[model samples]
Target chain A: MTIATFPPEPKPDPGWSRYFGFCTDAKVIGIQYIVTAFFFFLIGGLLAMVIRGELITPASDLVDRAVYNGIYTMHGTIMLFLFIFPVLNGLNNLLIPTMIGAPDMAFPRLNAVAFWLVPIFGSLLIASFFVPGGPAYSGWWSYPPVSIQNPLGHFVNGQGLWITAVALSGVSSIMGALNFVTTILRMRAPGMTITRMPVFCWTALAAQSLQLIGLPALTGGAIMLLMDLSFGTSFYRPEGGGDPVLYQHFFWFYSHPAVYVIILPVFGIFSELFPVYSRKPLFGYLYVALASFIIVGLGLIVWVHHMFPSGVAQWMRNLFMVFTMLIAVPTGVKVFAWLGTIWGGKLQLTTPMLFCLGGLFNFVFAGITGIMLATVPVDIHVSNTYFVVGHFHYVIYGAAVMGIFAAIYHWFPKFIGRMPYEGLGKLHCLLTFVGANLNFLPMHPLGLMGMPRRVSSYDPEFTFWNVVASLGAFLLGVSIIPFLLNMVSAWIRGPKATHNPWRAIGLEWLLPSPPPEDNFGEEVPTVISRPYGYGTGLPLVEHQDEIERRLDLQEASAA
Target chain B: MTDTTLTPGSVEAHGQHSGHNLTGFIIFLCSESVVFLAFFSGYALLKTSALDWLPPGVEGLEWRTPLVNTVVLVSSSGTIYLAEQFKARDNMALFRGFWLLSMAMGAYFLYGQAVEWSGLQFGFTSGTFGGTFYLLTGFHGLHVATGILLMGLMLIKSFIPGNYSGGEQGVQATSLFWHFVDVIWIILFLLIYVWQ
Candidate 1:
């Protein structure tokens, strides 16, 4: 007749086997995505090292042109598709339901299907390496004539496996997007309104909207390309009566917005981390959220920016130029907002916080470099050079990947009920940071000096920088060791983590660390006062009644 | 603040649509709209190019086959709407007949399109206009075929006692899908047959 304050004895759910489409345990699914993504991250990193090693000397020394193409192509593909997107979405799927006081995603079956489909699509892409001619040699962008004229494209794969891979991934993304949006919209507990949901959820919603709208174009493009290759209809071939430029138009149509798709959520993660670690509510929450939406919107129009030098009209070029420049304004709002969040608050220098701060610093430099590429004259010079390469790696690897690691380290306890080796995590962050800059920072100069991307080797003048870059890459490789060790060691013998290890005030803290098979015992969500009430003027007691209601609901259901 | 002030279920959740069928219809429209925009843009851009050629082999697309298909398709939309009206009024027999009639007319339209395709001289391989024509029409045809299949499934299910529960919302979702397909064909008819 008394409400138990804690689980009298850990009564894990036995009924979870019924929900078998996806891993019913949200934490398990989250870790599955994270660990697999981390594996790809290392593979991508190795490819990066291969690229740098080959470039270490001028004039085609280390690897042949074909292998070099495979290295960088798979590198970009794996990092973008296999690493950044999955890691972020995986984290979101893992965290958002728990964060918002929901027992599971509103559509858990769809969540399972989407998560599992990533590896399926991913293997098809990774499997391309062993194909007779080798992986998609037309570059990561896979621009036509070069891409379509090649023997191993969608047609020769004849299985439509390439198209199938991209589309399956697109399907996964669309489902994930829909689930993220619906869960945030419908399933929030009584008090958790639009304004009160976590910033990451808000960003995820915006990013997912971008995905839902943006991915269809890519799907349509891939479908058209598949038809072009398989059926000989000319979607992109002029000889077949299709224009290659049409493909570019359709391709950039998605790929440009995709840039935001990759970066914005990571930005969201940092947005959440900065405020939480700094012990401050996010500065300009409305602006940050609005900026995310604006970026998704404005991102659509700037696809032509990538095509400016490819013979687009001057006026069209200038139009995209202006839109491309305007992107900086919202981005500026975010940078200022983050700085504001960290400006005057108690700062936690935990490993996760270190990575967050490092990501911010690197992202600022990358943003500046991105702005430089937006200029007509500047882009004309560096359009196909290592500058573009360096710029993206900084954003994706330096900023987004770091943000993912920060989230993993920060939230590992919630998923696995054990802390990762913090000392190793810190060492990983430091080495990865130093090595990332050393590896990519000098490439800007190499690019300025006219070292082209996608080439096997460069001139002697570029030799020194490539060597430094290669050395840095090797260090980056070394840095990954700690993370892997930490993961393995934690899995083997780490101490069990306490619930609310960080004492963070979010609904996730209410659940058991590593959570139960059913997530929380209650099917219905209980309302909470605020998503981030810490450092706000709100009283802590505002959340207590709702928490008690959830506990009572769980107890009653159990009885 | 107390919980009493807020109404239960005030939260605006997605995935819930009623008789209006606005949400799914809108989503479908948005997707179709994007496809059409791509087609129109492709058309408009290509037409402006130096290759001022009509589809070379499509000289055989006599107006009659398309005009007849258009009539069949448009009338099926009306039939679907009438069926929805009858269902709303609980006229199960009328709903059943009209729904079947709508599917039949849809099948007839698709058959007409197939016959028309068989007669057409321009293949998808020929040129820009040819490729664009086949791609657009082919994609539209696929949608129509899917719509027909969905309606067939719904129609069969509706006949089984207690199968559909006379749910006002489920009936609306089906009606909306049919109406959407109907509207799409009207546009396709105008763009492909009449405009040319």
Candidate 2:
């Protein structure tokens, strides 16, 4: 029930209410991020169910067409800006210091400042939904011309609020990225070399690097868009001799790299989970780390692929296609590494591990389809179709969300000091895995069959598959209820777990569950062995007898 | 001998991190580069796509004021460098004086920019040319304003007994930012004021 105290020095505990407001502790901030992000995720998910409901009978029965646009736009905005990125960043804040054997993030106050920006901007974004014109209905990307000259975009408050909200989130992301980069690079334990650090930190470094470097491009574009909208600028207006496609260029420059921003951290979590569950030292660990850097570099160049259909020259199109395909090489290295890590080792099929495998299934499937969509010929056919939609969901929801859940379930004991109920956890995983596939899978065939996306009503011929897809989405919606119940109940009433619940070998496990005010109480931890030492002769627990003996010596001398 | 000692040289030597945070500063510079790159790319796109680099009937953009302001801004970077040197020698008065001078130069440049803006024939809404012109210069001016603010803070902090007696990281960061603004302005002057 208790971890061994190195010197038995007790520290003051922060009371429960410290979590309700601004607290500089990374653990508190991390929990704040997850709880707030989950609230947003529920909102986004509910909007998704509405989207599916509207698609059920191929008629605009449930909501008006314009309102439907607002639904999907808000859904994408919330799930992305509020849910995925922030949740991952929250984890980064919580786990980075503990994993690297540091007492806290390099800049703890800045970390708190970064998180506080989220709710302020997220409220601005969500509040856009209630205004007279509804939220920005030009889609989440909000490309100009449709996003600019049209009255909904030009004169409305919704688009303006959306732009401001996203820009604020951009500010938040920049701060968090800088904090992560500095902490990972400068604050590693003295004995822990970069090579010996966990894969999660490496991937976090890659992801946060891309964010700080890439997100400003989007911020600049948004400012230009704002000027065009409110201040009589023509940055994207063709009548004023500004090129619309150029805005797409600037937008994709940030957003295309943003795909890696979303995935690299999730992929990092994958690296951590597989080694723990499979009971093996990670195979090809260096390659896995190198692959993230490669992905970050390669991901930046392929933003042009999204601009292919819109007046890009033939040469540019081919260039982007090649770069997009080339990115698959580094990505392939990661997939193989995951497979090799689990190939001959013992596999623990716990819920967290099950979610990891589930996420892997989606990742591989999405990666292949992604490469298919990357091809110029195939993309020209399916650019605005359901195939693109399906492919995106498989990667975003299937991979990123699944990996997040895997991390959540795996680290629940560390956060809540209890294991999630296994039966319900498995059931939640099954429903999600089955529901996700059923929901997104049919869209592929429908896309190839020429079903255009973003339509509230479609051809009668598409109704059958659309109905089935709607059912899958509903199932996905229902799936989260059990997950929520499981988490809440498990946190409050589940059986207690020991400090090293999973027998994992990491600096995090060296401390008590839910840790102390400062993690690794009494003394700072220093690493002496490799991070993942499974199935090896290295002792999992370290003894600090010298330090303990010194403490006694000081006490004896005082006596 | 506690590490939290606020003496400038000791502060840099004390932290677990590189107190100069040169890497963080450089990374921030990269992000700022991307932002400015976006503006530059926008301008390029608009210029190539337009009938004229300047809008129809909009002629005679002033060059002398911006050129003079560019020199003034660039010289402020020199002044900040002088401040850094003065502080490194543990000369507090000269450090504070040169930093204040650097900020005054930045303020003078901003005033010059305003005078030039008042004389411009076209507004932001005039056309693509005017829009790009105003956006680029406006963003640059904002950076200069921020640089001035940061330098002012550094100057005030320098007077706090021993905060900048040696290896002042805040002052160095402000210098980097000011120099970055100056460099961006040079590029802008070359693009928008010179050539066709």
Candidate 3:
């Protein structure tokens, strides 16, 4: 009869100052990423508000035409590069190691380097606002000919800075994707087979793989564009016998899969939270996990759908149309799996659950419009219109952002060792859901009625929907107040959380709240079964009782 | 019970760690290859569409020095491989020798490239041909310089006693990168010099 003595507990949580410096601890880096990205998110949201304000009436009186272009371009660049991508990478840093029972990421220092590049390039991007030409007005795509024309004659122009920022961003993401794929593939604990891993990790694998394969094309393209703009390479100049459409091919090759890179993790969040809140195992779990790869596979061939109105050959357009529509199949499988998970189970409508539900509804709406946009006829008709704008907002904000919120709420306890105020959480969710629908829903009608996007002013007939959308945009702006208030207050003075507050079945839930410096310490919990074992009473880990006692002792000592 | 506990301080664990690093480096190289692919595809597209492949006054690329440069660069891959083999066999003297030889070959190749660039009549802004030519080769030359620098670091680190006591993963990764640079040059050689 041998009694096993527990190992020494890890050092206490380094206080808040750890985040400001170049720390290699994945948890600290994760929070830094999230906090920094949120700062950019607020900046992007403010830009959107300004744009909506300009479009409130039938005139471009609020800002100059050139300023409007810069505003929208910065808005798109900040939201995608700074907000969505970094925030998700932050979540990956926080969650992947804990879920897979690794003590740290594969290359922690490399991870820190990737994090610091965000701020460096993010500063460059924001600084372009103060530059000579006042930031890139050539849209986020920054296609050639227009992109190459540097009228200011200053070498350090807005388009130059934008391209430099984007190229550096591509480098940062490639480093991040490399780290993620290596960590997930190499660092899993004993008994955590590929199949037994949580679906979130699977989605991370798929999404990061897309980053590995697709990001370089855009990076390469950005470099060539920079060369043409600055060094007179003429790779995209028409007079220099360069093709502008080639840049479009390069940009969309990565940018189209980039949507999947954003949404796939949201899908993972949906998979994880549904089973926890609904008290049922994720239905067709294997299918849901494998479908992420399917999305990745299809996502690569479908970038030409974005070029339908760009004078692509008919065969190319039709081929990409089929590929784009095929994406809906895998996406549909995930939606079905979520519905089935919650169909007959005891549902807990917590803030996280509510957000997931809202996100799912919005995602389905977005998917339908996405399929419509996939069809060449419909896409050609609504090309460069508000309909395209409406559909993507439904995906990016209505679906992906809402899913991020759900993930934040669901994991807030684990992150900060406290329970968020449900009253405030629910209020925040209500405002966001209603405000988002009202803001984006009217764009469909406006697009069908022939109101083009990127214009500060519109026809007088389109003014009604614009008013509704602007009011909704203001309401959406208000929705952020409750969310910020709840996070700050709850983090400061909320009730302390237990190890497994939600009674979730995963390796992360077995650790202390705000898990120790090296998550799981010496006694890594070996995952025995797949995650999401809700209502099945199956033990998720091999030595569950022993691990729980060790965790409890650590928590007691820390307190 | 599928218990696959990797006990610390075991040889198997060390091998697994090295294997993990190799896999990561390979994946990184795969991504680098895609970046090159983007440029190559761009070159192919432009070549198919252009009315005149070369600028009006200038002749096509001179293949003599580039051919010698290609030979020098490609042969360096073999030298680096020999260095790794010697390091694996615990012959530190031969390992350092072959490693230095490989680095010299890489530097010689760079010198040949610079000489070729200096002699060229056309400049970067001359036309599509000059643009693609310089961009592809210059970009590739940058990679070669990076590989040489990595190899130089490895050579310096080897002099410190017990520097590689942990493992030779650094040397291995550097060699892999050198090889990747060599392979890319072959393709660039075909596209820019031979195919033209």
**Best of the candidates, DockQ:** 3
Model 1 chain A weakest 10-residue run by lDDT: A1-10
What candidate 3 gets wrong by more than 4 Å, as runs, is A1-13, A549-559, B1-19
Ranking by DockQ: 3, 2, 1
Error of 1 at A94 (Å): 1.0
Q: Which candidate, 2 or 3, has the higher lDDT? A: 3
- Alpha-carbon TM-score of each model against the true structure: 0.91, 0.94, 0.97
lDDT of 3 at B152: 93
Cα lDDT of candidate 2 equals 0.84
Scored by Cα lDDT, where does model 3 land?
A: 0.91
lDDT score at residue B20, model 3, on the 0-100 scale = 68
Work out candidate 1's RMSD over C-alphas: 4.0
- The digit string of per-residue lDDT tens for model 3 on A1-559 reads 0114333445565778888999999988998999999999999999999999999999889999999999999999999999999999999999998998777888888899999999999999999999898999999999888889899899999999999999999989998999999989988866788999999999999999999999999999999999999998888888998989999999999999999999999999999999999999999999999999999999999999999988889999999999999999999999999999999989999999999999999999999999999999999999999999999999999999999999999998997899999999999999999999999999999998989999998889999999999999999999999999999999899998878888788988987788877776556655678888898888897667666776677667767
TM-score of 3: 0.97
Clashes of each: 1, 0, 0
Clashes of 1: 1
Stretches off by above 4 angstroms in model 2 are A1-13, A150-156, A539-559, B1-14, B17-23, B165-167
Fold similarity of candidate 2's chain A to the true chain A, as a TM-score: 0.95
